[model samples]
Every structure is written in C-alpha cells, then in structure tokens.
Target: MDIEYSFNKRPTTDQIIELYDNAGLPRPTNDKERMEQMFENSNLIITAWDNELLVGVSRSITDWVWACYLSDLAVRGDYKKMGIGRKLISLTKEKVGNQSMVLLLSVPTAIEYYPKVGFKKQESSFIIEREQ
Candidate 1:
C-alpha cells in the first residue's frame, strides 16, 4: 500500500462530492451555487491519494492573519489510521501558519482526536443549525 500526500491542491467539485459520499458526509445535488461553495471558499484544501483514489480531505476557511475555522476533515473509512488524516491536518495547519487561530466543532468521537493535534476543549460556544 503505497500512499502519497498532496497538499494545498484544489480538488474538483465531483471529487469533493465523491469524497464526501465515501466519508459518509453530506452529498451535494446538481446545484452549481452549492457546488461553487464547496470547501467554504477555503483557499486551503488538503487532499491525500492512494494511487488514483482520494483517501482524505481537509478544508479550512482562514483570513491568513487571524483565525481559521476548520470546517471539515474526513478520511475514507478504509484509509483511517494510516497517517493520511494526520498529514491532511498537518498540511492545513501549515497553510494556516501561526498568525491564525485554528478552530473546529467536534462530535464526541473527535474529542480525543483533536486534542492530539494541539486543540483544547473550549466552552462558552453556542450553535444555531441552519434550516435544511
């Protein structure tokens, strides 16, 4: 199993949709506006490839000077724990650099994972879900 990492490279809309599908995240319809908004306008996207297969994706929306909100991070289930996810996180962290604060909202499962990458538990935050 030879795996390679490519960072800061933009993946196509179809690639994103497929990766999201494999990760069990939301899949997009044929709407161009939603398609255009993939990755949250993240100029910084990290992807991992196992040969031609997309194994991982990490997206962040950052100002490059202050704070960065890591919107989504996923790895195909078969590819999990192979360092692909860590590499994606590393690449995204490097892109954000030191000037920006990295932020994310995690489900219970991620609480252990995030702290391994230098994220601390934060209180005093609230969320209002969008109408879907």
Candidate 2:
C-alpha cells in the first residue's frame, strides 16, 4: 500500500462522507452542508491517500501550542488494521508539536484502539451532548 499522507489537504465532501460511512464513524453524512462545514472549519486536517483514493483522515481544531481536539479520525473499512490511522495521528501530533496535547472523544468501538496509539484515558472530561 503506497499510502501518501498530506497535512491540510481537504478532501471533497463526498469523499469524506463516503469514508466516514465506510469507517463506521457515525457522523452527519446525510447533511452535506454540515459535513462540508465540519471540514472547512477545522484548522488541522491530515489525510491518507492510496493513489487517488482518500483512505484515511484526521481532522482537528488546534491552536498549535496548548491543546488539539482531534475531532475525527477515520480510515476506510478495507484499510483498517493497516497503520493509516496511526500514521494520521502521528502526523497530527507532529504538526501540533510536543507542547500541544492531542485529545479526542472516541466512538465506543474505538475506545480500545486509542490507547494503542498513545492516547491516555482521561476520566475528568465532560461534554454537553449536542441537541442535533
């Protein structure tokens, strides 16, 4: 797999929706505007591509100094078990540097996966669920 990684390369909305669906990430793929805005507003984005296919992505909001919220991490279903997700994360951290901490709220299925890639489980976090 000759996967190439890019920082801040925005994938098309269709590509992102397809990937999120394929990866079982459970985002609002049905709402195109929301999906488009999601990526557009994100400050940091890491993408993995296999030739022309967008295979993986990591989307984050960061200040590049103190904290980075890795809002989305998705890899194509067929591309799982490869290191694409890990590499996307590694690149996200690399871009954010050591001073900023990377954080994310993992999907239930991925709760076990995060720790393997260097995310510590934080018990103090809280969230007000989105009404949508």
The alpha-carbon deviation from the true structure for residue 42 of candidate 1, after best TM-score superposition, in angstroms, is: 1.9
Instruction: After the best TM-score superposition of candidate 1, give how far the Cα of residue 20 lies from its true spot, in angstroms.
Output: 1.5
| lDDT (Cα atoms) of all candidates against the true structure | 0.76, 0.94
lDDT of 2 at 80: 97
lDDT of 2 by residue, 1-132 (tens): 699898856789999999999999999999999999998899999999998899999999999999999999999999999999999999999999999999999999999999999999999999999999
Rate residue 78 of model 1 by lDDT.
Answer: 87
Provide the TM-score for each candidate, comma-separated: 0.82, 0.98
- Indicate the TM-score of model 1: 0.82
How far in Å is the alpha carbon of 52 misplaced in model 1? Answer: 1.7
lDDT for model 2 comes to 0.94
| lDDT per residue as tens, model 1, 5-114 | 77645667777777777776553535646866866566777788878788788877889899888778888978878777777777777888888888888755667988
Clashes, model 2: 0
